[model samples]
Target: MAVAYDLEGQKRAYKRWAPYYDRVYHKLLADAHAKTARAAAKAGPDILEIGVGTGLVLPWYPEGTRVIGVDLSFHMLERARDKMLSGAAPQTRLVAAMDACRLGLADESFDAVAVPFVITLVPDPEGALDEAMRVLKPGGAIVISSKLGYDTGAMAKIEEWVAPLMKKVGWSSAFRIERIKAWAEARGDVELTEIAPLFPAGWFKLMRLVKRS
Candidate 1:
């Protein structure tokens, strides 16, 4: 049996993937991430983007939002940091190479947390979400843009078969939407704010959960 999620494996994988990531993943990702970024900007002027790969979402953030983006991949984070230094990410407060499951930020410090196509990619999705909630201020928001694990689409079966290969590309197909909901519900500290389908690909969704007051 293969390990479902290995943080070190993902780190090594992303390191090998960083150079061509923007061209390949960016092209296929299209505007799915942009939509989430826009929503995140509106929800927060102090945002923490969990997987700010290559600073792709940085360009879309509002000018006033202070985005603190983190990624475990040093190679990927280097690109994000470069964008911030070059003024490509004008509102980026900082871009650090850090783990999602174990963040070093102060509790209740961020107004919102953004995880774009990233939760399922981590070793512990629940832990990652917990950490997101950890640093987020009460009433803060969380935005997620990614392909869910639910079997709603016609390609679900086919996707499942190819999931093993996809894992090498830095994502797990085993993550369920219900898992995300359950995490929030278990904490009793968040409300489902949005669960809209992302267009062009119905397999994906844009979700928002607001921390309770």
Candidate 2:
């Protein structure tokens, strides 16, 4: 488990970054969300969105789709709510202060679960994935899109040197796609599929894991 101080620091950092987040991450998120949503079209309805910061992906959801979005940061959720209120995905529901590792939702409650760029932020990603799996109905799918492989070679060296400083200033450690795949596959019922890499040095990957009945 990550220390409470680390978690709180992360939340504070993200809150501070919220204003500029869309500008910084929008292009990457747009491409990834489009591809992931297209692939997830087969899953159908009652989607649960974990770590739904600012609800940027809410607009990309197919028409008539229902959404239940959960987030840890109250500030982020407030922004998401404001977006929703301003006619962004008018039907999407919001849940404030929910932890990814311990979802408050009932088991097998949703048809699909979408988690974009969230795994890397959590301290125990395995626990978070397990919670996602538990809430998804059998045969439902979990769609995840993230910037992976951010720590390698030169990047790894830079991170190793800068991580302590970054953590002190409330930044998260880098994530690797391979780790997420392994975590997903650890669940006995999951069937994993790795999507083609997008721009910016194969850093983005779309992973789809279907839960078997």
Best by TM-score: 1
Worst 10 residues of 1 by lDDT: 1-10
What is residue 177's positional error in candidate 2, in angstroms?
Answer: 2.9
lDDT of each: 0.83, 0.76
TM-scores of the candidates in the order shown: 0.87, 0.82
lDDT of 1: 0.83
How does model 1 score by TM-score? 0.87
Error of 2 at 81 (Å): 0.7
Candidate 1 Cα deviation (angstroms), residue 51: 1.2
As for candidate 2, its clashing pairs are none
Candidate 2 deviant stretches above 4 angstroms = 1-5, 150-174
Evaluate residue 129 in candidate 1 and report its C-alpha lDDT on the 0 to 100 scale. Answer: 88
Model 1 agreement with the true structure over 81-181: per-residue lDDT tens digits: 88999998898989888888889999999888999988767777878888999999988889999877665665667668777887896666677778888
For candidate 2, the lDDT comes to 0.76
